[model samples]
Target: MGRIGNIINRKGKQDAKRASVFTKHARAITVAAKEGGADPEYNAALKTTIDKAKADNMPNDNIKRAIDKGAGAGGGEDYFSNTYEGYGPGGVAVIVETLTDNKNRTAGNIRYYFDKNGGNLGTTGCVGFMFDRKGQILIAAENVSEEQLMDDALEAGADDIITEEDGFEVVTAPEDFNAVRDALVEKGYEFVSADIKLIPQTTTVLDNEGQVKAMEKLIDLLEDDDDVQNVYHNWEITE
Candidate 1:
């Protein structure tokens, strides 16, 4: 009975985390739709964002509402689009992806976080070259053969496929993200997450104690900032 209770509690916590992540992702989709166009057909980026939202279990109503807001018909304000570059502890380059309506406010808030957290915000090109824009997809590895998965991804134009500890990671070029994802879905693959993110070209290895503290502080700051849509770094997190 004790073990069963613990299992239930763990599942509940996992569900909550998933829900929160989906909410954040939904905000990103809304912002992307507003920046580009409501029609996914005409806007490839919007389509890619929407596909990710769907994969995340974002409700259809929520998706429609976000699109309406993006179209400026649902009383949703416009969001600004910007990228922030910075360096964390141990000179780890960080890229913060943001969608904000007010650049000054966002910048001030971001700067404050960095200042307080022992990092410094940098100019536009300071750390961007250290990362590459890549389309990443996460799918459950359950009941799926590695060979089969690789074959499908290769046929669908994936750049690389790897089996991570938690699941399978599918990588694609920025342009082919949507088509490759759709191909996998048509073939009945269960996706965990799919989106374009700044992938670090090389990783910075951190020592034992510094890793946890830096990661905790970074996550707290990033999650609190409404302007920060996604945060990426090349800090190699190890057990």
Candidate 2:
């Protein structure tokens, strides 16, 4: 996504980008299966993970192998989730989510990135209160009217609909995520992206090029790490 303003564009090679996406999805599927059991029917989380993977066109064989690894059929390595909170240049708050097998290694690497980029890693929940966790679904705006999308989304239990530059966003409560998503799917709405995110309540604006450059470098470093699952920040860049 190359979104101007609040949304940071993810720019990279198409092939490498796709491979990274698939790897992350596979890891998520494996973890969900390992923790919740291999049967998606009995495991709501696993089912949702699979649905997300399928939406991205993840190969069936790869999905099956990940599930197998989680069930010990393919000898999967153990992994655990970790989160880090910190402040970047211009007092911009950021939260980094990670899935890792080695806590020390990941922590060291994360701290280094923050320190090297004129930032500091803070204790857990340092900036969490500044954001709201919500289920987000993004769909293309093409061939659809705003009124129509809003009506359908609200009726499906979505809390709100935000009209983005190139798409429509449906925000739902965590518990109502699956219900709203499935309902929209039934109505034949295809999504560009669907997942839970920590939306910032207030954003920090960077006026100077130096601050913007530092923020970008911090984000790029964090995202390049394989253990880092997602990075949320409060810096709002203007065009």
What is the C-alpha local distance difference test score of each model? 0.76, 0.84
Q: Write one digit per residue (lDDT tens) for candidate 2, span 154-179.
A: 99889999887877889999888888
Worst 10 residues of 2 by lDDT: 4-13
Task: List TM-scores for all candidates, in order.
Answer: 0.84, 0.90
Q: Name the top lDDT candidate.
A: 2
The superposed Cα distance between candidate 2 and the true structure at residue 230, in angstroms, equals: 1.1
- The alpha-carbon deviation from the true structure for residue 132 of candidate 1, after best TM-score superposition, in angstroms, is 1.1
Model 2 spans > 4 angstroms off: 1-15
Whole-structure CA lDDT of model 2: 0.84
Off by over 4 Å in 1: 1-27
